[model samples]
Target: MLERLLDNPLQDPSGYRQRCFEVKQDAQTDKWWLYVTYCFPAEATARSRDTVVGVDVGVSVPLYAALSHGHARLGHQHFGPLGKQIRNLQNQVVARRRSIQRAGRRGVVDKTARAGHGVKRMLGGTEKLRGRIDRAYTTLNHQLSAAVIRFARNHGAGVIQVEDLSGLQESLRGTFLGGRWRYDQLQRFIEYKATEVGIEYRKVNPAYTSRRCSECGVIHEGFTQAFRDQHGTQGRSARFECPACGYQADADYNAARNLSLVDIEERIRVQCA
Candidate 1:
C-alpha cells in the first residue's frame, strides 16, 4: 500500500483504472521510494535527435564509445582506480566470510550472544563494509554514465547505443578487470540517464562484436578463453587484426565502431524521420 499521496497525478485517483505502483525500501538505510506507472504518447516523450554514439562495455576498458558523427577515443580509464576500491572491498568480504565460517565451525560466540545480544562484531563489520561497497558502486556508476552521456552529447550525439549484455554475466562472473567489468549496472545507469535527459537509448545483441572486423567484412581468426582472464591485458587487447583485409585497430575501439555500424540503418532512418 502507498504510504502517502502523489504530488502530481495524471490519471483520475477516484475512478478505477488500470495502474500499478511499486514501493521499495533501501535495505541499508531504511529509506523508502515509490514508483508509479503512467501512459503517454510517444511524441510527448520523444526528443530531437541528430547523432548516435555506439558504446562498448568491456572487461579491460570501462567504456569504449564510437560516435556516429565524429571520432571516438579508445578508453575511459578513470574507472580503473574506482574499480581497485571495489575489488579490494570484494576481497575483504570474501576473507570475512571465510573467517565467519571458521568461527561457526569452532563454535565461537561473542560474550553477549547467550544473553540475546544482537549485531555480532563480525556481522556488523561485514554489513558496514557492504554499505561502503554499495556507495562506491553507486558513485562509480553515476560518474561513468554521466560522463559517457556528456561525451556523446559534446560530439553531437543525441542517441546513445549500447550492447544488450543480458547474457554476458557468466562470461564476466569472476574477474573484476581494472574495475571495468560492471556492464549490467553501467548499462542500466546509461539507459536511465539517457531517458531522463530526453535523449534516445537503444541496445543491440552483442554478438561477434570483438571478432568481426569493424573496417572489413571478414571475421578475425579468434581470441581464446585466456582473453577472459583479468591479468596483464588479456581481455583488453590493445589491438585487433583482420587477416582478410589487413585492417588493424584498438580492440575496444573496434568493438565500439562495430556496434555503431550495426545500427547505421536505424540511426539514419530516425534522423530522417
Candidate 2:
C-alpha cells in the first residue's frame, strides 16, 4: 500500500515513504509519521573511554550543549544572527495570517456577505508564506544537528545526556504559551544524528538542575543574577556563587553538572540491577 501511494505521488501528500525511512503508526497521532535512520561505524578506538555530553533545551535559543572534556560548545551558532533571521521570518508569517483574517472580516462588513473567493485567495497567500517559514526552520534544525555531531566527534564525546521532556506538551497546558516549543523535533534530530555516528544518547529527569547550586548542593528557588549579586556578589554574567563556599560557575555549566551527576546515578542503578 505504501509503495502504491509512493508510485502515484500527490502534489502535496500528507506524508510519503521510502527506504531507510519508516512512517510507523504510533499512539501519539492517529496517522503515521516519517522517520529516517542511518548507521555508521564508530570513529574512536575501542580503548578510548566514553565521555558524557550535556544538553539544555530552551525556547529562546533552542539548545545549549556542553561536554565533559571542554573541547567544544555545541549549538552556539543557533543563538546568533541566523536565529534572529528565522524569528523574523516567523513573525512575518504570523502577521500575514492575521491580515488575512482581518481582510475577511472587513469583506463581510462592507458587502453584507462574506466574499468567499477573496477570503480563499487571501488564505492561499498566507499558506505560501507559511511554507517559506517552515522551510527555513527545517534548514536551521538540520544545520544545528550537524554542528552537534561535529562537536561530539571533535570532543570525543561518546554519550549525550538530554532532559526528559517527554510529556512537556501536556504538562504546559493552560500556561502563557503552550505547544510553542519544538523540543520533540529537536530531540528527534539529535537522536537520529547521534545514532548515525554511533554515539549513545540518554535522558534524565530535569528536576532542580537549574535551581540547586552546583558547588554546594544548596537549593535556591529563584536562583537568578539578582539573588546571587545581592547575597554572594558573584559578579555579572551567567556565573553564580554558592553562598556557602563562594564557588563560582556559569549557570548553564552548573545545570550540566547536575545532568551529568544524574546520568552517573542512573548508570550505577542499571549496573546494580
Candidate 3:
C-alpha cells in the first residue's frame, strides 16, 4: 500500500525524502502492518513575497481566516454536527457499559450461565459503535487541516498565524475546546503542512483578540460574546459589538481580524528598536 502511493507518477515526490518505515497495529484491524511516513525538505516551496493571514480558531466555528482582501471560514459546515455525533456516541457507549456492568453484578443475572456471554456481546457492540464514530471525526479533522494549509498557499501568504491554544483546552473541557485532543491534532497537521510548504507559522497571545475592537483597537471592557451560526446570523451565538467604534461582526471574525494585525505589530516593535 505504501509503495503504490509513493510510486504513483501522478503524485509529486520530488521534494520529499525517502520514506521512513514503521510497523504498527491499526486500531480497526487489531493487526500488525508496515507503514511508511513521508517527509519533505524544509525549502521545498520558496517563501511567498507577500501576504500574511491570521486564523482565528474557535470551538464553535473551527476556523475563520482573515485574508488581505476578504475572509474565509475553514472546515466544513457539517464538522460541528459530526463532532456532536461523535461526542454523543462516546457518552452513550460509556453509559451502555455501565449499564451492562450493573446487570452483570445483579444476583439474578450473575447466576445465569449466559450472563458472561451476554455482557461480552453488549460490550462488543458498544465498542464497534464508538469506533465508527471516531473514524468519522478523524476523517473530518484531516479535511479541515488540509483546507487551512491550502487556503494559505492559495492566498500567497508568507505567514500563517494561529493562537497558542496550549492551556486553553484544559481550561475549556466540555465546551467546544473540550475536544482538546482532536483540536490539537488538527493544529499539528496545519503547523507541519504550512512549514513544509515554506509558509512561516506563528502563535500570538489570544487574550484580547476577541474583546478588542478590530477597527479602533479599543478594548470593550465587556462586550457581549456572540456566535455566528451556519445560517450566518450573529444573534444565534456569541458575538462582539464594539461600543467605541460601533463595529459589529461575529465574535470570532472580530478576533481573526485582530489576529491578522499581529504580524504588523511585531514589525513595528522591531523597527522602533
Candidate 4:
C-alpha cells in the first residue's frame, strides 16, 4: 500500500506531483486519528554532511538530547498532565478489575456483571488514551530529531551518537518498571527521522556508560549526592561518579559522552579498516 502511494505521483498522466501526502484514519473519537507517514524525498544526494547527536531516553522525560554544539534540548512533554491522566485511568482500571474479581469470589453475579462492563469500558478508554500518548511521543521524538539536525547544521557536525537501548527491555521486563517506559518506539522514531534528515546515526553499547564517569574515567557504583544535587536529580535513571576529578553531570550526560567516544572510536576503526 505504501509503495503504491509513493508511486502515485509518477503514475500521474499529466505529470502532476504530490508533495505532502499522509495516510491517516479516524480510530475512535472525532478528534482522534492514526497517522502512517510516507514522506517523499525532495531530492537525492549522497554527499550530504553528517550531524552528531547524543540521546538519552528515560521514563520521566522520555528524551534528554545533546547536540554536538554543546546545546542541550530536553523533552518533558511525556511527563506532563496527559501522562498524569493516563496514570489515573490506569489506576481506575486496576481498581475496577480487582473489584470485579472480589465480587466474583463472593458469588455476587449482579454487581460482578456490572463490574465486568465497567472494566470493558475502562479498557476501551485506556486504549484510546494510549493512542494519544503514542501520538504525543511521536511528535516529541520528531521535534528532538529536528532540533538535533538544526544544531548540526549550525555547528557543522556530521555524525550523531545515540545510546543503544536494546538491553533496556530485558532489564525492565516482568518488573513494576515495565510498561511505563516506551524505549522501542522512541528509538524507532529517532532512527527514522535521522535517516530522513541524512544524519549519520550510530548506536553504541550502553554498558557501564552510566556508571563510568565521563571525566577522569573513574568508575563508581553510583553518582555522589553532590553530583545528583547539582544536576537537579529529576532524570537520573543511571548513576556514575569520578573520584579523580570533581566532574559532575547527569548520568545521561555521562552516557552521552560514552556514546560520543564510541562514535570517535568507530570512525577511527573505519579509517583504519
Candidate 5:
C-alpha cells in the first residue's frame, strides 16, 4: 500500500516536487512504513489575499469560520461531524483497553498474563492503542484543515487567520492531544495547504477575542466558557450574548468573526469609543 502511494508516475505532467521522506517501523509487527512529502508551485488566483477568513478552534466544534466583511459563515455543519466520529473511535479504543486492564487486575486474565508485563499485550500493546488514536487525530486534522482552506477559496478569501496557541492548555485539559501537538498539527496543515493556492495564513493574538462581541465590539468580561457551563449551553450550539447591545449568536461563530478583523484591538477601541 505504501509503495503504491509513494510511486510517482514517470511520465506524469503534475509538477509535484518531492521535499522529504520519513520512515517508521511498527513495534508490534516490525513492519516499516514510508512517508513522502511533496510540494508544488502555488496556483495564482484572480484576486490578491486582501479578504480574510477568521477561524475559531474549540474542543467540540473543532472549527468555526467566517468572512471578515460579510454575513457568510461556516459552522459545525460544514466542519464538525468528522471530528465527532473520530472522537468516538478513540473513545471505543480507550474503553476496550480499560476493560482489559480491569480484567487483568481482577485475575480474570491470569491465563494470558505474562510475568511483569501485566495485560499490556493482550488485545494489542500500548503502542497499538496509541497508534489508533494518533491515526484518528491525523485524519481529523487533515480533513478539517482542507475544509477550512476550501471554504476560504470558495469565498475568494486570500488570507486565513486563526488565534495563536496561548491559553490553550486550559481548554484542552481533557482532550487527547492536550491541545499542543494536535493544535499545532491542524494549524500547520491549514498553513501549508493555504500556501499551495497563494493564500496567506496567519496566527494572531487571541486576547479577548472570545469576550469581544462581533456585533457591538463590547468586551464582556463574563463571557467565558464558565458562563456557558452555567447556562447549560455547550458544543456547536453554544451561545454568546452581548450585554451591551443585546447581540446574540453562536459562541464560536462570534469569536471567528472577531478573529477575521484585520486589527482586532483597533476595532475594539473604535467601537468602544
Candidate 6:
C-alpha cells in the first residue's frame, strides 16, 4: 500500500500532487517515523444520490454510519480497543502529573532544600503527553473517516450527512474528548475525504436526533438522561427504546439513521408543532 500510494511526482507527474513529508519521533516508542502527505486526482463516482449515509459522532462509539433507506451500517466496533488505549494514556498522564505535583509540594512542607526536578520535568512530560495524545487522536480520526467513506462507497452512496455540531463544544465543557476537539475534527476529516471522492457531504441540524424515532418520527421525550438513569441505561448504553413506537436499536446507530433523512429537521419541526 505504501509503495502504491507514494508515487514519484517527478517520475510520473500525471495525476499526483507534490508530496510533503514530515519526520517525527514517537513519544511512546522513541522511534522516528516519516509521514508523507500526498493528493491524487480521483475520478468522479457514478453513484446515484438516492442513498444517503448518515454518520453520528459520539463519546464512546466515536463514529456510527448508516444508510438512510436500508439497514446497512459501519463503524460499530471501531472504538473498542483504540478508544480504551487513548483513555488509558490520558489517565496515566493525569496520575503521573498529580504525583509530580505532590512530590514538589513535599519539600516546602518539610522545610528542606529540594532538587528542582518537578518544574522542568513536568513541562517536558506534559509536552510529551500532548504529542502522544494528539497523535492518537489523529490516528483515530484517519481510521474512522476512512471507514465512513468506505462504507458509503461499498453501498454506492452519493450523499453523506453528519450532525452540525457548532454548539457541541459548550455542552462538552467537562469532557476530555471535547477538550481535544475530536468531534469536529472527525467530521472535517470525513468531509474532505468524501468530497475528494465525489461524494456530497452535508451537515444537518442535530435537534431531537437521539430522541426521535427513525421509524415513526415520534420524539420520545422519555429518553432523557433521567430516563436513562431510571432504567439504568446510562454510561455508554447501546440500547435506545422509543416509548411511542417501541422502536429499539443502538442509540448512536438510530441517530445516524435519522440523520440520513434529508427532511429530518422539517420532520422534527412538524412533529413538535
lDDT score at residue 100, model 6, on the 0-100 scale? 62
Query: Please, what are the lDDT tens digits per residue for candidate 6 over residues 1-273?
Result: 356555553636445554677999977669899887767666466987989999876534556788988898875465576566656756755776786676567545665333455555555676666777677777877877898899999999999999888867675433224454577778889988998788999999888887888888888887764454355434464468877778898877888899999888898999888
Higher-lDDT candidate among 4 and 6?
6
Please give the TM-score that candidate 1 achieves against the real structure.
0.68
lDDT of each: 0.63, 0.60, 0.64, 0.53, 0.75, 0.74
Each model's number of backbone clashes?
Answer: 0, 0, 7, 7, 0, 0
Candidate 3, residues 64-102: lDDT per residue as tens digits?
677644665443363566556645655765676676666
lDDT of 2 at 99: 78
Q: Which residue pairs show backbone clashes in model 5? A: none
How far is each candidate from the true structure, as Cα RMSD in Å? 7.4, 8.9, 5.5, 7.1, 4.4, 4.2
What shift in Å separates residue 141 of candidate 3 from its native position after superposition? 1.1
Backbone clashes in model 1, listed as residue pairs: none
TM-score of model 3 relative to the true fold? Answer: 0.72
> Model 5, 43: alpha-carbon shift in Å?
1.3
Error of 3 at 263 (Å): 4.5
Q: Per-residue alpha-carbon lDDT of model 5 for 151-253, expressed as tens digits?
A: 9999999899998886666775433333444787898899999998888898987778888999888898887666765664443344788999999988778
Off by over 4 Å in 1: 1-50, 74-83, 89-93, 96-100, 103-119, 174-183, 225-238, 262-273
Model 3 clash tally?
7
User: Which regions of candidate 5 fall more than 4 Å away from where they truly are?
Assistant: 1-14, 20-24, 93-120, 173-181, 234-238, 265-273
For the record, the alpha-carbon RMSD of candidate 6 to the native fold, in angstroms, is 4.2
List of clashing residue pairs for candidate 3: 225-238, 225-239, 226-237, 226-238, 226-239, 227-237, 227-238
Clashing pairs in 4: 50-158, 50-159, 51-158, 51-159, 52-159, 52-160, 53-160
Residue pair clashes in candidate 6: none
| lDDT (10s digit) by residue, model 4, range 92-124 | 556655655664554545467677676666566
Question: Among these predicted structures, which one has the highest lDDT?
Answer: 5
Worst 10 residues of 4 by lDDT: 42-51
TM-score of every model versus the real structure: 0.68, 0.66, 0.72, 0.59, 0.80, 0.77
Rank ordering of all candidates by lDDT, starting from the highest: 5, 6, 3, 1, 2, 4
